[model samples]
Target: MKNIPKVTALCLSIVFISLSSISNAQQRYTDYDPIADFYNRFWSVPLERLAIGKLEKIMLPNLKPKAEILDLMCGTGHIAATLHKKGFRMTGLDGSAKMLEFAKKKIPNMKTILADARYFTTSKKFDAVICMSDGLNHIMKEEGLTKAFTQVYKALKSGGQFVFDMNWEERYIKGWNLRGLRVEYDNSEGIISSSYNKNTRIGSIKFWLYYPIDKAKNTWKRKAWELTQYCYTPQQIKKALQTAGFQTIKAYEANQDLGDARNAGRAYYVCKK
Candidate 1:
């Protein structure tokens, strides 16, 4: 009876610690479905079109006509669509089913795979594999990024090309420190809040989306989700590519030839096996 208070306090402390662990885990994990479902509605507009168009023009000269291509992390199929129109056989792969649904609607008869880039595999190898638009930044772990690179290497045919782009650490440190960005479309709108942790080098963005109940009504539906991206330096990217068995690698800054200098947050990489 004399020791009852001490035992009770220890048990309470354990419970409190467990609860804190669970909360932290929840904060670290994010579900991508909401962002996927509303992806095109909010993103890949005129600017996205222009970027994809420019990228296609720059890469087209390097690829054989009608080459089989795999667009890894093929969000909303923007790049795949562009390449397909230019006569490349494209298969889009992404972890999000909802995003694939939108992509299918945009490009009918397109093949898509629902799998994480970290562990994705395919029996059908590709002539060229692309993971663009800073898709590698979403891995959140260096090991996971390496896994994705290795998987992509395995999925490419001999002497095949891998082209992708990544946002430099500079972008996260300076650009992603945003607060309450308001974005609007025809009948939908949203506010985006973003922050970057200097120590972790992880950038997080929270989206709050509003949809009109009716065109004339004041009522709206709301949805929210959080996304996180890890930052990598140019040297880190090159090392990953080399470790994944790429024979040669060339990285081009956005302003060099491919994209507009105004959008110089990212650099493009071309590697060959």
Candidate 2:
């Protein structure tokens, strides 16, 4: 029949579309099992206690005093609080309301908005933009990452810089092996959560959680979920920034300029719009 080939083509197209939709739907739901304050904090163990300090040392030396700064994906306003105290006009943005709840208390004077980095804009452009704590990894796809940098460019004044970080597959393989991956953090409040994720190189680490909401309660356990991403190399990051209209792109190792094992084993990006 004349329609036989057309029918077969339609069936194959439907199947392919269904499979692609399934994969995207899976990624849409992948996120951390929420605890009181832990998941959004992203197990601060990998970063030093002074993450804000290390990051500030990177930018503050070059930043003009009293400049307007935008903190993209500013979880809990950690660094923003410090920068605000230093007399910088700080505005923090993140998609997490749970984290923003904590941030409001920490930096009462700083402004915070709940918005994803890729789609947010402000009435005022900032002199510089920074996203910390591996915030860039959460973007997941190359298209979204490009959109994110483009948004940063739109939000920044000319000659402004956009800085962000993420895990490198190269470094993750070298150090993020499952054999020794465990994290425990808590304050003497009404909560405690300790958890670990087995290693997966393809995209993200599969993570689990055990959180106690109350000290009086015996157990608080939530099952695990996968956080997926297309990991980018240093070259890929620079290329994406360039595509997004960031003219001056640079990469840095975290602690030492040569490549700090903890922070810079992979790298962070500093781009000028």
On TM-score, the candidate that comes out on top is: 1
Model 1: number of backbone collisions? 0
- Candidate 1, residues 45-104, lDDT tens digits: the string is 653565565556556677888999999988788768878988999999887677788789
lDDT of 2 by residue, 136-222 (tens): 776756777888888899999888877777767655556445532455545211222222233433444454433443435433433
- What is each predicted model's overall lDDT from 0 to 1? 0.72, 0.62
In candidate 2, stretches whose alpha carbon ends up further than 4 angstroms from where it belongs are: 1-33, 40-50, 180-201, 210-222, 255-259
Error of 1 at 90 (Å): 0.6
Q: Which residue pairs clash in candidate 2?
A: 254-264
Residue 243 shift from truth in candidate 1, angstroms: 1.5
> Cα lDDT for residue 47, model 2?
44
